[model samples]
Target: MAEMRLIKKGAEAELYLTDWMGLKAVLKRRIKKGYRNPDLDSYVRGSRTSNEAKLLSEARRLGVPTPVVYSVDKRNCEIVMSYIDAPPLKRFVDGMDPEGLALTFSRVGEMVGRLHRGGIVHGDLTTSNIIPYSGLLYLIDFGLGEHSSDIESRGVDIHLMRRALESSHHEVSSEAYLSFIEGYRGVMGDLSDPVLRRVDAIRRRGRYVDVNHRKEA
Candidate 1:
């Protein structure tokens, strides 16, 4: 095995770019936590790695662009997957003009809708998790994704994306989000209502709303 170069380190995992079995791949290795019980920590890491790998393949099958898993080592709490060469959306979204930015966000929303329709909820939905590839948007980083048919989970997914946009690209956030909802509705059809209503309910709960969201323009 060629030495895997560390690309990022996160709370749960470390990302490495490597050549696995002569194939270029991104390896996600769950970080070991010393504070937790050994047995519990291993179980948590292994399960999350397995879950993320499963969700990555499943989401791709549902026509949601995501990396292809090459192999997994449960003992090591690592997953080797195809690497995407595109930059995350957060790096580019702001450079686009209003119309262009909204158009891109609409595609992001549609992808999320497609995932939801397939019974998956991306627990972490943010600009940083999206990539532009082959003239389309690809969703990445399924560390927080799971299989869920619940409306609340689905609402929370979209909610997170909207909040991400608001904070990351404040200028085009609202307009882009409206476009996102349009694309989501287009794919969700009749099912969009319940989830959207749940999103409003979540906002009303007050936990997701910060002073910035409450302030008038």
Candidate 2:
């Protein structure tokens, strides 16, 4: 219970900037849902808290840069981890020249590729969850991630990244995504082909759904 300052609050959790064992840390506490049964809520939160911690450690073990996990308090549904003192990639990617942007995203793609190759999928693959620090891209917030090597799961990761870029970095989305693909291919090689194909198929399905919704409208 070190002196804490609220940093970010989301629907499911709240992030607090605090010190842990005299080191800078971020404490993520899953919030309770008033509507859910108290026991169920506690169980759900505790399960997710444990799972996220495991995913973070696994990702780091696979050589992806991630914040070091300091502690986990399942009863309270809290995890205290190293605080990454850098901007999220969503903000960091802004104002970079085309070359820099390409290089940066290429690296992003490689990191993700490494994760996928290691049988993991970042369920939430948005730039907002990424940090570029000390010449490395640090992946953070594994709350939504899991160990999955299925084609659909892997495709969803790439699709989510593309959608995130298009929504947040529209002006440079296409170029950035292409560069990402290049780097991803470099690591995944033949394995990347099927996933890329799956991405295309997923995109088409999305477009079809959008068209149907438009028709209904």
Q: Over the full model, what C-alpha lDDT does candidate 1 score relative to the true structure?
A: 0.88
Model 1 spans > 4 angstroms off? 35-40, 206-217
lDDT of each: 0.88, 0.91
lDDT of 2 at 19: 96
Q: How does residue 72 of candidate 2 score in lDDT?
A: 96
Q: Tens digit of lDDT per residue, candidate 2, span 1-217?
A: 7999999998899999999989999999999999999999998898889989999999999999999999999889999999998889898677999899999989999999999999999889988899988888999988878899999999999999999999999988999999999999999999999999899879878455342344533
Evaluate model 1: give its TM-score: 0.90
List candidate 2 stretches off by more than 4 Å.
35-43, 206-217
- The residue pairs in collision within model 2 are none
- Per-residue alpha-carbon lDDT of model 1 for 70-135, expressed as tens digits? 998988998999888877889898789878887887788789889999999999998888888888
With candidate 2 superimposed using the best TM-score fit, by how many Å does residue 144's alpha carbon deviate from the native? 1.0
